[model samples]
Target: MTAEREAEFDFTHPFYQTGLAIGVPREDSAGILRSLGALLSWQFLSLVAGLGLLLLAVGSLLWLVERRRNAEQFGGSPAQGIGASFWWAAVTMTTVGYGDKAPVTLAGRLIALVWMFAGLIMVASFTAAITSALTVSNLQRQINGPRDLPGLRVATVADTASAQYLTEQRIEQARYPDLPTAMRAVADGAADAVVYDQPLLQYRNRELGERRLDILRNTFAEQLYAFALPAGSELRGPLAQEVLRVTESAEWQSLMDAYLGHR
Candidate 1:
């Protein structure tokens, strides 16, 4: 139903509400530069920094265990041995296994063996940490709700209440011919979001079947679907009473679920 205004036909008590919602692509549709930029965010950088520190710590421990007795591989001045150990730690963690260095002492060999497994575990953890950081950064690029629409490429159906709402908020938008096109615009990276009726967006997205889009849970500028009648129609009062009764009934809920889905 069209969003109601008192100047038009008389509207009965609202039987259903379809609020305004934001729709965005399921995956990050940002450009390569944007993706690289997201990868450089503080969280990801911190993880890399932590990994560097962990490698240095492991290398220093190995250097201490080998410097005295097994100096041939882990020998030389303190700085040189630490540098060699650091190189070993880097290559071993990455599984490159250069095979140039070997620890000969019992304690040194034990430290090296322990570090091999520890490096594997740390590398796995570091990879997971980076992936999580990137995913989080990608999600942050997607809008959380209406508050994020400002300064973003907002798409909406032309000549709609949603467009009007955006205008009222002084938000510039790219108006499309219809909802599907607006949704497509977001998927195609032409727009950041599609603002439309909640239930309508839900139904349309389900039709896509690819889960290419995700609708924000938050709804704003709610619109009510009501029965419209001729102005001052004699049936308005009685019809409103019936609508309220039916809409409030359990059977009505079951019917809604049967047709519209279980929300």
Candidate 2:
């Protein structure tokens, strides 16, 4: 009697028939509903808030470490204080070393020990964080690191976008006049890879021992490089946005296919 009733109930439900037609199990549908519900819950928001807090904490830790070093170095100077330490930390990490200030005495030199090591780590970590954040922010919000390249030496063409990007990324490199000179530097063991655009890099790959050198997949800025001015300069932000948009489009993919001829 119970088996006959269950069979009738199953046949009567049109929803079950529809689910079978779509090849979705009822259990799977229920799981999807649960997932959707969770996404709408406070737990998801709390997770986001927690991640934000973690980032803030990391940033603060870096800042405090820098402050402590600065205080130890220049505690005596009238101009040197916690605030001044912050500026100094930024400069030091950026490797600007403007030499506007100096540290004196035994205590200061001791403090230098901590700064020297911590500064390098802090700079690399901070660069990665800021760049990653900025890139994501610019893409999502529509607004907007490294060690020395491991090789005997490397070169970038002077005043070009490649040079600018490499310099900004803090890669150890020299500047050369022409592509051949840069290539020569690498060929002769004076350098590793000549940092340049896709076209130039491709050319080098063909002309040189292709297997010998490798292109660093790590691209600094995806957008076509542009210049910024003090003010009233036309073709700055618009040009940058235009370049970025094109580079990310399907047309650009076709262009790459034609130009590169290989993935």
Candidate 3:
């Protein structure tokens, strides 16, 4: 079925017709988790810590150079001098020279120039790292939407709505027999990304473990999953009724929570 027809049927289908059946709740939960994961990731945290340490080291060096030679501006107990050095380093690194604290010695000014350039590079690198990790929607700033599909090596399962959509869009794609293989193609660098059902992709991501892959928050072409039965089957109505009953039950809600927790 076309995505539009499938979406219409999903809203009316017994499996999704209950009053509590909100649409695409899993996507919202996944988004929250992804954001949390990015912020708490060890790699990003380590980079921040390293930058802080580097700044402190530079501050310490500055205090040593100015401790005896330029005693007026940096004179006092070692601790006070180090504190002043730190403040200078911070202000200079951020390119916000308040001019309140100036290094008088030639050695101090030379060190300041080096630290300034190093700080500039470090800041740019850190910003790039954050942008790469958190901006999951645009993979490398390439795949913003379905319209940006051309020239990308997309992967999707055969006989799925995603495959059909790719065909209609005339986007280059590698069709796999199942979701696992399609996802693997992306992980293995054979494809730029995998396009599939959002909930199923989220489940797969959980199974694969943390942050190995990213899913785009923007979903397109919604569709419903249904059980296929023989034409004019006598059991269809009874099965559908059972599905409706189970879906609305507390037990079923618990099961859903277990699999896909609330955001």
- Evaluated at residue 115, the lDDT of candidate 2 is 64
| Each prediction's TM-score versus the true structure | 0.56, 0.31, 0.45
lDDT score of model 2?
0.48
Model 3 alpha-carbon drift over 4 Å, by segment: 1-144, 260-263
lDDT at position 151, candidate 1: 84
Ranked by lDDT, the better of candidates 1 and 3 is: 1
Q: lDDT by residue for model 1 over 148-217, one digit each (tens)?
A: 8788789999988899999998887999998888888877767878898887887777666664578888
Q: What is the lDDT ranking, best to worst?
A: 1, 3, 2
- Which has the better TM-score: candidate 2, or candidate 3? 3
Each candidate: RMSD: 9.6, 28.4, 10.2
lDDT of 1 at 160: 86
List lDDT for all candidates, in order.
Answer: 0.81, 0.48, 0.68
lDDT of 2 at 38: 42
Clashing pairs in 3: none
